[model samples]
Target: MKSYKKIAVVLTTLGVIGVSGCKKILDQSPKANVTPDVLASAGGVVGGITGVYSDLRNLWGTEGFLYYTNLGVDETLAGGGASNGGVAFATYKNYTNNVSDVYNALGGVFNIAYQDINTLNGVLQYGVAAFPDAPTRTAYLAQAKFLRALYYFHLVQTFGSVPLHTTFINTATLSDSRAPVADVYNQIIKDLTEASAELQNKPGENGSPFAGHAATKASALYLLSKAYLTRGWSSAAQSGDFQSALTTAQTLISTKATYGVDLYQNYADAYAPANDATNKEDLFAIEHSTDTKYGDFTPGASGGKINGWAYFFRPNYPTVNANYPASGGSGVMTRDIANGRPFFRVRPNYDYVNNVAFADRSNDYRYWNTFQTTWIANTANITTPRGSLTVGTDTAIWMPPYDPGADKRASFKGVIFLPPSVAAATTGANASTNTFFPALKKFDDPNRPSVNDPSSRPVVLFRFSEIYLIAAEAAYKLNDLTTAANMINVLRTRAAYRTTGMPANAVANMQITPAQVTLDFILDERTRELYGESLRWWDLTRTQSLIRRVKLYNAEAAPNIQDFMTLRPIPQTEINLVTQGPPIPQNPGF
Candidate 1:
């Protein structure tokens, strides 16, 4: 809950700063006929193309807006913080101070996104300048356009009609008024259409990160299938377009015959470090390596510190943290408990896999083996770090006792237990808390505390699973049931699907079914599979199901939530920064 002003300090130390707002400035003049020497070099051009990906990260990672649009709108997500340290998270409980609130103005999301737009714009301008050949240049432009489509997709989903700027921003004609949502979608269609044509089976020779290397031409087609599905949802688009999305999705699925998208043998290996030997079955995923020899850990961390924000989820929750079960040490969960309550807790850096010992020892696969007190695996057993305490390995897991009829203490119980008030002094902030809400173990790069440390784990931004789901939803919406079902089954089989029918338990809770695989199912599947990946709120908002979905998920608490709580209040900082235009009007209820 640190201030945007402080946490994500935006000045790019990488000399890439001078070219933030406008893109064309970074590229040489087209009219000059200056006969640029670098135009012909593939290596230089390739490097510049890759720089676009880095720039994309740089733009979105600031201000946590990426999380705001996705997480803030959806009530399924609740900040674990003990109290309101800031505007958005605090108001999130009441559905107030949302990112789209114009008068109150939650400009954080918009600000960072604009920077992303500019960054993409610059990358394309430079990419086109460097690769002028028909095929090669088209491919790069397609990739640029594809990435631009991705950004715009998020934009349209979040704030409705946003300004569409194709040219670089420095032109005297600085800005365009908010374009119609249909116009924006049309532009997105144009980009993806061109990209699909240029990139189908284009192979790893080109440099677009996710859909470039290892991904076949079918990858682009599959993405187009999803894009078409998005178009299918809009009444604004002409007839048969939804069917087009469906057909594209089916066609791409048929390519599985030529180049299959199999699951990694072990369901757990999907979340392993990027370059793991077992890391096959990927169509495309965000590439991250712990940058040890280089300066930082993630794409941006530097100088042995967390200058840039790294996403965190509930340390104990399995759904968050890419279904790794016991990942992340995260922001704390708060429960008002002055009167009387009783619960135990943990901190963000550490994970508490299981407080209770499991009855069966045979079934300890991913979560238990990786980060829990695994009695299941004797080899993985953790003894006392310093020994001799009631709570066993004090840092690893804590099992503070409170029998069913035992006298209640001052702690309110929620999903993950919170510590009693008596232990509040211990659970404040310093990570000394032996009792409180359990910590999320996902983002902990223990030895590499500082961003400068080269060897830190990188989180997956997008992956093959997402591709599969996107294909499923897009195809399903287009009435292509077979392809949609197959796309979904790919993900299902990884978890535990049987030949004749899925196990009874497989359909138990949070499990996917043919019946549940509607737009809602697609959204929930995404939530279950890719929780912290930053797409939840956008998915909810896109379907206009946020209010109903959030109310259902959060009926136990915050039940009186209003329907209009969906759109966020735009940030005040942005309105202040703007030199022109009416103060951006917020969505009605904010």
Candidate 2:
């Protein structure tokens, strides 16, 4: 039971020795400088393991990783604030593998992942001797293995075949080659299988060890199922991969009670800011806190460990009054913590939101639950063209799912935002622009210190609800339509509008028969349940639907996306760093 304070001190000490500015994976010399003698003690082993956890902050919550995972796919497009590096990801315009270009920023994941992998390798190598007690040693080693598997899973999924290093390097190496995708999957499965067997089953955020945010048996199982599911779609897929995935996911689903995780009854409650740290639906999350020392980055600092997920998908709501001058001086809306800082980096794809994902806005509560439709007036006595807005009582901005006719929209007191179709056709102040779409409410953090500060909320990386989706997907692949429909119905039923005036048969309306279980339907269901959560690109790629879906649903990216783009270009920096041997080749057609 080492205190978090002690671990933070060790993390700081290791951070100094391990920090490096080199962009290439092979050039991470500082990590190699971490001597084994430093990791040979029990306290050192704990610190080293905590360092691996800290590395996740660099990826899970950062803007670069967010763009890599969420943009240029069917679900999202470039928004008003996407003029920066993010627009390339969203539009796939001039997106290339060159290390000198903005796309190279995405390579941060590759570098940070290997850095953590090397650190984990050191932990596993020295942890046994550091902790002579068998149980303590096994617990520490299991967590390291789980993290290693997670890193490899992300790498393989993103870059196709990445250089695999399972041993700690004490010196920099000049030559490395990409492993076969099949080999990478094999290692991922092996590590997760071992981790799932050895790790404890405690729920997340329960005040257990590691501030109750440690990886558990459920986390390992979830990744294992995903690994199998992804591998089943890969060229290296085995005959039993889909069956293995289905069985593995079903095991976690059936035994969720023992794992101390379950889906929230209402989807909105799962993402409520107050429930963030202790949300039962979250199987694993990257922890962030207000404590500047251990909370990764300072809450409002320029850089470090801030979770910028709150910023990226938001629409520029504060500019709504500027965009429409009808709402007088005190403005109908102003920047507020509840509405989130408007980066407007990524906007939801119009077709995906309006036509595909939330087609049943009447029956599905997910449409309203997932988006912020109204902004309550925080300013006092704001006058609009139609009427006066009283503070806290009147709706200052309304972004309804459907287009209320011009006559109906003119009757509303506050500003009204129609769908992109109407906005695109309109002129002057109300004309189409990236800032006025429906703001995603899923990552909104009302608890931030100020309007512009980054969120301290732990990014929910894996959730219990995804387990059901994984099971449903695996069942669909296996042609077990009955099991697939059953698994999906559980989530759909939960997504139904449960309010009094909503349809009493909402749950029944949401339920689908086995005949309705197509690959496309499952993909749509995933968008309904997990859109803008940073899994869309992987989801689209894993199912080989990236090109087709992007063309159909994402007008901005459809013209430029190519088959070769399925696997992002292996960073050119990594290729350049191989000075001793033939340089690593870029992904085909890069």
TM-score of each: 0.63, 0.91
Best model per TM-score: 2
lDDT of 1: 0.43
Give all candidates' CA lDDT scores. Answer: 0.43, 0.77
lDDT of 1 by residue, 1-590 (tens): 01122111122111111121224223221211111233234433333334444444433323243335434433223344322312243235544533332232234446545554554455465556654456656655565677677667766766666677664443233213567878888888887777667663534343432232323455566556656666566645667776777667556655654544545655556655443322444544333344432212354333122212232322322221211113553212111111011111112111111222111112322222223221011112222212222222222223222221222211211111223322344432112232333332333333444332322333334455566776677666666667676777666555553333434554333234555467666665564455444566656665667677655443322454566655555444544444455544555665
User: Best candidate per lDDT, number?
Assistant: 2
Candidate 2 lDDT tens digits, 1-590:
00011112135321211112223212111232355776676656666776677777877877777777888888788788765567778778878735343555656776677777877887787666876667666777888899999999998998898888887776757778888999999999999999999887883222223335678899999999999999999999999999999999999988988987888778888898888767788888887766556665565654456788888778777766622655435556787888888788788777678778888988898988888879898887677667888878888888776767777777778887767676666542253358877788888877788777888788889988988889999999989999999999999989984555678889889999999999999999999999899899999999999999998888888888888889888776667777777668888988
- Which regions in candidate 2 have their CA more than 4 angstroms from the true location? 1-33, 97-101, 203-208, 322-330, 422-432, 497-499
In model 1, what lDDT does residue 161 have?
A: 67
- Quote the positional error of residue 533 for candidate 2 in Å: 0.6
